[model samples]
Target: MYSQQVIDHFNNPRNQGRMENPDGVGKVGNPVCGDVMYIYIKVKDDVIQDISWETMGCAAAIATSSMISELAKGKTLDEAEKITRGDVADALQGLPSVKMHCSNLAADGLRKAIEDYRNRRGMA
Candidate 1:
């Protein structure tokens, strides 16, 4: 069963869209669950100015993706990079044991986006 936070996010996912001319984009998929997540970010002065995502998976995946955007937006790259899968799961009041991997994808997607931004800017 899903928590209320999970249900809320799943029913009304936030940042569920694509970004135009994003500074970075990250896409990741879980073959086991056939879940795919795409995260886009825009940075200004090393801070995440905006963030969004597109996900194809179960409710947990959608909820996790939504939560990651909220957690990362307005955060500096270093701060956002520190957001872990446990943090995301906690933010959602915890996900089902079987669905925990969804959180990993969400966190990984965000980190990947930040890395992409850094690499594009020659910072990595």
Candidate 2:
């Protein structure tokens, strides 16, 4: 069973799209679940100015992607990096045990994006 928050996010995902000239991007997939996600971010002055995602996944994956976008926006790079899988799951009011990996992928994708951003700037 999905939580109300999860249903809301899945029904109306936030920031779900390709970004224009993203400062960084991350791609992740679960071969077993066939859930793939591409996270994109635009940074300004070491802060996340904007965030978005394109995901091929189920309701849990989609909701996690949506939640991470909301969590990352307006956060400084360090703050965004601190967002964890538990944070995404908590924000969504928790996910089913079997679907927990969806949150893990979401967090990993965002972290990867930040890493990519830092790497591009020689800050990694």
Candidate 3:
């Protein structure tokens, strides 16, 4: 069963789109489930000024992606990179055990985006 927050996010995902020019972009997928997620971020002064996502998966995947955007936006790259699967799951009031991998993808996508941004900017 899905949590109310999960249902809400799946039904009305936040920041669900691509950016015209993203400072960073991360793409992650689960071959086992055929779920793919793209997370885009725009940075300004070392902070995530904007964030968005495109997810192709079940309700849990979509909801996790949406929740991650909320968690990462306005956060510094270092801070955002630290967001974990537990963070997303906790934010959503916990996902079904079988669907927990969805949270890992969401968190990894955000961290990967931050890594991409740092790589592009030549920041260590």
Candidate 4:
């Protein structure tokens, strides 16, 4: 079963799309579930000015991706990088035990995006 927030996000996910000329992009996949997620971010002054995602996954994956974008947008790179799987799950009100890894993918994707940005900017 999914939480209300999860259902809400799954049904009407936020920031669900791709970005053109993104400062960073991250892609993650779960072979076990065949779930794939791509996260795009635009950074400005070390802050996440915009964020979006495209996910081919279950309800939990979609919800977690959507939640990660919301949580990361407008946050500084360090702040966004600090967002954990628990943070994504908590934002969604919690995910099913079996689907918890979806949250990990979401968080990892975002962190990877930030890392990409940093690396590209010679900050890494």
* TM agreement with the true structure for every prediction: 0.95, 0.95, 0.95, 0.95
Which residue pairs in model 3 clash with each other? Answer: none
Residue 29, model 1: lDDT of: 87
Off by over 4 Å in 3: none
lDDT value for candidate 1? 0.92
Please, what are the lDDT tens digits per residue for candidate 4 over residues 27-118?
89965767999999999999999999999888888899999999998999999999999989988888889888644589999999988998
Instruction: Name every residue pair that clashes in candidate 1.
Output: none
lDDT per prediction? 0.92, 0.92, 0.90, 0.90
lDDT of 3 at 43: 99
Model 3 lDDT at residue 40:
96
Q: Model 2, which residues run further than 4 Å from truth? A: none
Judged by lDDT relative to the true structure, which candidate is superior, 1 or 4?
A: 1
Off by over 4 Å in 4: 30-32
